[model samples]
Target chain A: MTVKAGLKNMVLKGVNLSIGYKLHGGKVLHLQKELNMELRAGELVCLVGPNGSGKSTLIRTLAGLQKPLSGSVILDGYDISAMKVPEKSQLLGIILTERNTVDNITVFEIVSMGRYNYTNWLGTIREQDRKKISKAIYLVGLHGFENRFFGSLSDGEKQRTFIAKTLASEASILLLDEPIAQLDIPNRVEIMTFLKKLTHISDYSVLVSTHELDIALKIADKIWLIIPGDKMLIGTPDEVIKSGYLDELFGNELISFK
Target chain B: MSKKYHTTLISLLIVAVICLFFLDIILGSVTIPMRHIINILFSRTDNKGWEYIIMQLRLPRALVALFAGAGLSVAGLMMQTLFRNPLAGPYVLGISSGAGLGVAIYTMLSGIIGTGAGFIISKLNYLGQVTSAIFGAVVILIIVISIVPKVKDSVSLLIVGIMFGSLATAVISVLQFFSTPQLVQKFALWTMGSLGDVNWDQHMILSIIVITGFAVAIFLIKPMNALLLGESNAVTTGIEIKKTRYLIIISSSLIAGGLTAFTGPVAFIGIAIPHIVRMLFNSSNHKITIPMSAICGAALLLICDIISQVPGRSIVLPINVLTALFGAPVVIWIIIGKKNLRTSF
Candidate 1:
């Protein structure tokens, strides 16, 4: 059982994956199939797609929140589907698109929730857990805002709080679904840049689905362009632009990337 | 909002609860002096009349107010959290309506079923009603529990609960239409809700159930806190969603069902007290809210009971009437005055 790890330090790998929903009468609605995706440690990847192109479905499938229609998701060396929830949680974290603003909960409390699996049955925050929670709040640039009510914070601050919660988990792989969807231009740019900085400084593998193609192209280490017909074009931003599929998907006349 | 402020507020609530507890016992149809009531409670009073008034009449009634208030409020908090709906209460899941239906069947159908059953039921009386109410509540709760696995989300389950409630109400309505006026009045009086009907034996059972419910709520604080982060986020935090949901549902049902069995589906307190406590503490931390809700709920119900007795007046209003009259305005006032009221859901 002495299998050597890969040279590139792949943190998350989706092997021959099929992503979709199981509808009424056990009818399988396949969105995409046989998609082999790789997210390496310290890499920032952006999954760009048209409105109905299954970006969220892919992220959910890879995160193991939803079962894959077929194939497997491997985390580090173990099979994701086979791993228990708490064990899988220690390795992966996700920030969903829903802005679930809990009323009356403070930023500190929300971030402390990331330590749920690590805490005792009573969810007591030990000194070490407290330090990690504080560090996470600081890392997300929300130091003084810790005691502020989550509902009172701005949308940007709220998103940062959620990110802080995810960061507190110390998961190596982070998946975000439309993290900056509702933000204004400035806040959007700030969140994207903050995520970019996170990937560079830490051994975290980040995958975010976004409609902000320009920012994604500018900062992403790799661009995964999903188009119609359940197909994905995976490569560096330069390779994606040079391939001319980006222009074709946007239709050369309406909106060209290059 | 500060820890110190919360401490001060909690202390204030405890003092209010104690004072109200005494006030509730002191201000019934026959107002008794504090000293006399104390002497009676401690068994040192020679005034048999005051002693009887305090011990037999007002004492059990006041205790009912306290236990029902606290238990129902905690149950309401759980339902609100589980459903993420501001209007959700202990009755939202149709547990109360099911209890009502159970009562409706017992009170109205017994005579029609024949004199043998009616004789037994008449002899059983209060015990029969409590048994029937519990049976009804447990039945609806079991049905709701069975549907939990089938539903995809909490919202769907909330709808299912509402549907079951409506179904129970419809059945009760048909029974009412066909029954005699006196029997219908008996059922109607039960619907008006009461804190005075529970005897000492029932009080012992209610106390045990409410105390156990509080203990279970304490154990659920962590998982409930995790749930404050929406369902998906909660799952990411390694919370067992199905297990947590089951614990919350069963515990809330036990408290709400037990209280309804004794108190005839006491209204408003269950749904309103949680909101008031949340608004007062300005914290959604279950650690703080659960205990605070208990105290505030107990205080509110005692106040309601005092008002219902009308001090020197012999006429007593229904408990539900006073609760809705007072509970509605207070919740409205808090929501209106406090613009920064956070949505605890």
Candidate 2:
């Protein structure tokens, strides 16, 4: 056999992927490129780095929101571009930074959006659809908010409501871009920990981008330190814990973890 | 209590309506009391013109206020929910302008339809006007659909709708420039908007159109709620967002289109009444919003129509002028409300 670092369920490959766009650097306009990335399922991979490190641009390419500058994104030995939107939606559940609200919409109604792939064009919810909605709401711990007006909820509650919406998506691979950016401190911890447990206990896997280095080291099964002064590396939180990654990440002079 | 609550609202509105309708008829430019007005409506009156004034003129005008207000406002409530924008109204879709152009085109051709007579309307030509209004509204609706983006965020879509309204206005103005004096006068009069023009037959047509259109709109309650959460979110939640948006625009346009086609461009109900319903119900749920706007819109229009008349003179204000009097203030009020202001997204 061979040595493989990630958990058993996930094995994804990126073949010579080069991604970037033109950015103006005063006198000159140039392109930024990250040549490669390989992700495995069952690992909490954190894409941590500095502001202009192309972390978001990299994530955007992986999520199929943008076309790659060059190279291929292959998932489970299948070309990503060939897959249908519905099929892609089923495989990857994404939590973007955008929040959704409706006047008379309940938490359950919003979460039920995850089941659209199963519903017909006529727009009616079936029995299994209801079950999925309930499961999603329960997963996000928003049980009683089923009938609340969407606009009345607080910001933190709104974020959790979106997570509940994501849960109903029934995806095996989760991609989150700063999911806790809109949350309170307690909610941030609660949501992050809950997501971590879900990835560890279930067959699902998550790739998240965040600035919370302390929390990332504490829970992540594997850390992806997008080093400032070097190439990207994948290892455990302990291995990358004392590296200069955090110091360069925040541009702090002392380089101490609070 | 919920049953009693709606009943109480219905009862109160009905009572207010009786007072408003009587005041609109008997108190206009004359001090006829309750008994004389009853005599004018039913009994053989000594006056030659009394029956004509009460039967043909006053009664039709009152019905106009009742239907025009409720029809446009109910349409507005549905649109605001459908598009998730408080500013969406019949005017936004260019329905009024489109239908007006259609009627003007019909009026120019009214002579050919055998109804073109000076101050003496023939039934055949009048029917042509009705047909033209519906056709115009439908055609403009199709054009607007082509230009509108089916994106999730309806906030920017509102701007697109406003742009469409301006475009339609420009086209109609060009149409007006080429028309004869008589036809131009007719179009101008129609645009000023009046509840004083339609007869009993026209009223029946508008009633049927509004009732059917609103019925279709009511069926869309669940889907509209789903859409407000976001299109992708709505789609995954078992709603076909594009199909739903199409259904809603068609129904709302039909109702508002039918009304404005027959009655010119009655304004206030389409823009202001939905916000009023939101404030009163303290909820934006369509179940409450739809029916509440129906009742409240009718009442508000009846009041505005009553106010349009001089309390004791022959002076009559155009319905459009009166709606603008109230609608403009509401536009400013909406701009000042912080809840509305917070939406930059």
* TM-score leader: 1
Error of 1 at B332 (Å): 2.3
- Lowest summed lDDT window (length 10), candidate 2 chain A: A26-35
lDDT of 2 at A17: 64
Clashes per candidate (backbone, < 3 Å): 0, 5
Q: How well is candidate 1 docked (DockQ)?
A: 0.63
lDDT of 1 at A244: 85
Over A4-96, each residue of candidate 2 has an lDDT whose tens digit, in order, gives 244355545556666666445643221234456666666677777767766676666676665677787776568776766666666667666
Q: lDDT tens digits, residues B1-345, model 1?
A: 568998898899899999999889889787677788888898678898888788888989999999988999999999988887888999999988999899999988675764667677777877888999999999999999999999988889999999999999999999999999888998889888888887787788988987888888888999899888888888888887888888898889999999999888777888888888887777778988898888988999999999999999899999999999988998788778877544665
Tens-place lDDT per residue, model 1, A1-258, is 122233237589999988999999999988888899899977899999888889999998898888999999999888998888888887788998865558679999999988988998889999999999999999989999988988888899999999999889878789999999989999999999998888777767899999998999999999999866857889999999998887777655677777
| Candidate closest to the true structure, highest lDDT | 1
lDDT of 1 at B108: 83
CAPRI category for model 2? incorrect
lDDT of each: 0.87, 0.71
Residue A236 accuracy (lDDT) in model 1:
96
Docking quality (DockQ) for each candidate: 0.63, 0.20
